[model samples]
Target: MDTNHNKGDKSFKIPGDWIEQSKQLKEKFSTLTDHDLKFEEGKEKEMLERIGNRLRKNREEVLNIIKEINLS
Candidate 1:
């Protein structure tokens, strides 16, 4: 997995356990469908943007939610 982290940037790695994390996300946000959390290689940015847009949240907020899932 190509995980990158940069300060003040909306760049972060999709966790290796993304499949599990995505499942958690779907549970947290019941409205999210399988298509919403689909992970396409090389399209991580697009996926994140889609998630943020669907949830009406910013990139940072989305990242935080994903991060919280990883920590759990």
Candidate 2:
């Protein structure tokens, strides 16, 4: 069978779930409206911080996968 079917001839192919996660993260970050981010209000800033943490974690996972594939 074709174990590399998901990758095919592409140089890289991130797992499908990472793409979904990235989309969700983008949607979340996009919700921080200017009104919600007024100076000193902090709510929007805090929301962004939380999302940023999650994004970093997800990004690290994707990077690790990419590195592994490259090393092989």
Candidate 3:
């Protein structure tokens, strides 16, 4: 029986060193500033989709890493 409250949440609890890893991940993705990013003249939609996909993947990766640490 699982008694964890955050089990279903995509958000992971940061455990010691994993906290640092999460911070690094956030810093890495923070480079994509709206003002600094440019899309091709006709590729606005495609660019948005690509950014969304990357964000989702990155989030999952961070969560997984946190989970591993929590389990250990």
Instruction: Put down candidate 3 lDDT per residue, 1-72, tens digits, no spaces.
Output: 978886644332334563354445446677444432234555534544454565654545645544664555
Better structure of 2 and 3 per lDDT: 3
Regions of model 1 farther than 4 Å from truth: 1-10
Model 2, C-alpha of 16: deviation from truth (Å): 28
Q: Report how far residue 64 has shifted in candidate 2, in Å.
A: 23
Q: What C-alpha lDDT values do all the predictions have?
A: 0.85, 0.42, 0.48
Q: How well does each candidate superpose onto the true structure, as a TM-score?
A: 0.80, 0.23, 0.29
What's the lDDT for residue 14 in model 3? 38
Count of steric clashes across candidates, in order: 0, 0, 0
The superposed Cα distance between candidate 3 and the true structure at residue 55, in angstroms, equals 0.2
Worst 10 residues of 2 by lDDT: 35-44
**Candidate whose lDDT is highest:** 1
Model 1 per-residue lDDT at 2: 71
Clash pairs, candidate 3, are: none
Best by TM-score: 1
Candidate 2 matches the true fold with a TM-score of 0.23
